[model samples]
Target: MVKMLCDPVCPPPNLSQHPCCTVKCWKWDVNQITMNNLVKYGILILNRPITQNSGFIKNLWNRATIRMTVDGGTRQWDKFISGLSNEMQTTIKDPDLISGDFDSITDEILEKYKAKGCKVIHTPDQDRTDFTKAIMELNTHRKQTGLELSHIIAVAQTSGRFDQIVGNIQTLFLVKEELLLDPNTNVFLISDDSITWLLMPGDHVIYIPEETRQHKRAWCSLVPVGETCKYCTTTGLKWNLDNQSLRFGGIVSTSNTFDGSEKVTVKCSHTLMWSMRLPTIAIS
Candidate 1:
């Protein structure tokens, strides 16, 4: 079983004296299959099959302040709910918005959601991927509605076509430049087996549960994306890096485990993709 920890306002005492401008804290409540105190967050379903357990996805969908689908994801969302019980289907409401080029979604599916009161947006800019365009639409929604969501959880799978998977990651890097999001806004990619997000150059405190740190099969990784990390340091990992470099074809931390600590700290000179395996939990 995975342990749950409350979100602390400040870093723990051990990390209090760390010489970093700002300390970004993270809690893996979603990965641990638990709900935290309701905060402003949105869900963005991509154009992929919803392979996650229905109940789990439903819980997230209901809790999300805003729900959206991109292109064929409208079909995917409809198919996901179609497999649920009548009670479950009724409880899971239609997406608040649907945006993407119409190339992938059929007219019938589009019309169904539109009639259900979903805001259908046609974004035909071929320069950006559907995923990227969807984020833009999400931002626009936030402004128009004054939602001010602090987090965006993108539900996607990592095992699909390699190019699409990489394209999704590229979108993470492009988010800051694409729009003026709050400096603290976080974008996460929730996969079936792992929770991944980009850690910009700064100090970060990621709270991992005690059970996960000690679990034999649980693992985490720090992959430098787009550029080489010149100075990277970490603590609470089985294989901690001490101001070492991490880059492709050189040194990257993959399949690394936690060092029996409830939290993992990372200090990197550049952006690094941090991913951790989800604890094995039986979904009803």
Candidate 2:
């Protein structure tokens, strides 16, 4: 068993320092998850090299060191690779790495990132998407860098095969508690304090930022596998729901706006997923 020595100011000597005390066993009774953890390192993982439409490419231009993994898809590989060149030039300025099996990836694009000295490793695992492998690689990098894995803004995680999307999200639930990821694991979002992960069946409050401010988009959500949420209560959205029961077939909250300015709270009788977006910032 791992032991922790905690002082108010400094952490224990020679002990692993997690971004939050939640990773380690804490003696203090914390009421709920908050947004305080967003201030630290924010890691973004993109599954498959970006497919840049004119609009999507422009939006991703500002992000730094985007580690991308290309997938082996049934789509037209040549056309995808040819179209990506110009967009890669326009949107990606950082040393973005491209990795995955070469089945769907072209020789031209592989040479491009490689020539630029971006680290590339080809792991042709048939059991998982290249995306899943990339996430594991990022986890290893996180441990090596001594940074806790944060919000992963993954593209193509859901847009690919329907089964793949479900599988990727399912992996989120299996993540060890110490890893501490946002509820929507495959999305590019984060919280300032802490993201509330689901529990079995009980009443719990999730802290959220109130909407009445400058930002119009403040909230987002994901349904857990099987989507068996019996009931949920939220206090931050523009439309408040009390004792509302939601399931797989019902309304799945994807893009919900916030109403308050400071923080909103959520209570659920069953396990539920809720996440807030964070501004894109660079980490060293």
Best by lDDT: 1
How does each model score on TM-score?
A: 0.87, 0.54
Q: Which run of 10 residues does model 1 get worst, by summed lDDT?
A: 5-14
> What lDDT tens digits, residue by residue, belong to model 1 across residues 1-284?
22322232333222334455354644434433434333678888988888776777888788889999999888888888899999998788789999999798899999998899999999999998999998888888888888868678888888879999999998888885444354456678878756788876667777775556666788899999898999899999999999999999999999898888877888887778998876542232
**Regions more than 4 Å wrong, model 2:** 1-66, 72-92, 145-149, 157-161, 176-222, 249-262, 275-284
Once fitted onto the true fold, the runs of candidate 1 whose alpha carbons sit more than 4 angstroms away are 1-33, 36-38, 280-284
Backbone atom clashes (below 3 Å) for every candidate? 0, 13
Candidate 2 residue-wise lDDT, 127-159, digit = tens = 765656666666665566675432454444335
- Model 2 TM-score, all chains together: 0.54
Q: Choose the strongest candidate by TM-score.
A: 1
